[model samples]
Target: MQTPEQVAAAFDLLADQHDAMRWDLALSEFDASVLASLEGIATANVASSALFLAGGSGREALSFVMHGWKCDLVELSRRMLELAECRLHKFDLRIVESEAARYLADTTEKYDFISMVGELVGYVQEPRSILRAAALRLRPDGLIAVTWVDSSSLAATRQTEEQGVVALVERDDLEIRAWTCETMQKYVDAARLTVVLRSGRMAESPRRFWILRKEM
Candidate 1:
């Protein structure tokens, strides 16, 4: 319900706070679950493949790569990219200072893995559009990971409107468009992908994460 720019600015500040929430065990549950659920794909196989992280500002997913997996991140901010680089300097990470959906939709490039995290999912009106688009960027048998807010989750009940930045979000019914695990399935089902993994609701904030693989 907040302006995209306002939300981005607020998150940028939070990124500086400690990034504690980003790496929380519950936070990684979505990622960990998706990784575990995929039985056909070898863990190392997906990890070693090329990855596109739409809306990967601040490079939280980059840590996933350096710490365990191996993949590149796509972000929309130069400043965020710089910070990500600083934190993930040891890996073979590459970045693009543009929106992930924009890049995948406009370019001929394809990846073996794609992670649509935080800002991208947290702010889109059509989160599925990004997932469908990301699916296009994947080669056959490639995997796409998507995370988004679960609008129906009771988690939001405790988050008073006053907690976010002042006027941080708009009060439009548009928030109803948020994608939860239940609804997100429709998107993946509609897309030309096979749902391989899915997870959500690890914390008070209800966010859904899905892992899909392009059919062979």
Candidate 2:
């Protein structure tokens, strides 16, 4: 469980290498697939507005912006937002440099969709609180997408010796908590959000994504 400041510092330090490192991990493809699935749901639901939590470098939200969806991205790292600004200059994208939970707490605006992509929820110390706040900002039929690493996988087993915290970029001093899919599911269920879609595999790396909707 990392604090907002700690999470921000870690990401700020990695901002420059973030894109390259993520690309190496095949995260871009995974994100694209997630976006494609979300797009289908959005189209079916006639959703036009979105709130993206921990939207790093704004890649995942770029298509939504191009599709004329009103998009607001909440990211903790100023450097990441700077990069996003550079790439998304033509669009009126609202980029907020704040912790996702805090930003959601302060906003009264609701959206047709909200996404916490790339396992961002895993880094939070209190994911349930974030989910609760997100639920408040979600429209009645809107969807919330969350992704995380599954704890029951071989990857999680290997990380157990390190207590689920991994050092960033091989820097032994800085580490972030690695959350499990079960733990994330608990939080989402506690927030009273229903799981509408589930995807991903649990073998070695074990990444999982879920699409949730607030119960009427």
Per-residue lDDT of candidate 2, residues 39-155 (tens digit): 676456553889989988887776678778889999988888888887787986898888887888888898988888877766766656888889989888788888876555434
Error of 2 at 158 (Å): 11
Alpha-carbon RMSD of each model: 6.3, 3.7
Error of 2 at 43 (Å): 4.2
Per-candidate TM-score against the hidden true structure: 0.69, 0.82
Model 2 residue runs over 4 Å out of place are 20-29, 42-47, 154-174, 178-182, 202-204
- lDDT per model vs. reference: 0.57, 0.73
Residue pairs in clash, model 1 = 1-169, 1-170, 2-169, 2-170
lDDT of 1 at 49: 55
Residues 72-136 of candidate 1: C-alpha lDDT, one tens digit per residue? 67665445666667766777666666666567777786677666655365565455677787787
Per-residue error (Å), model 1, residue 202: 4.3
Best by TM-score: 2
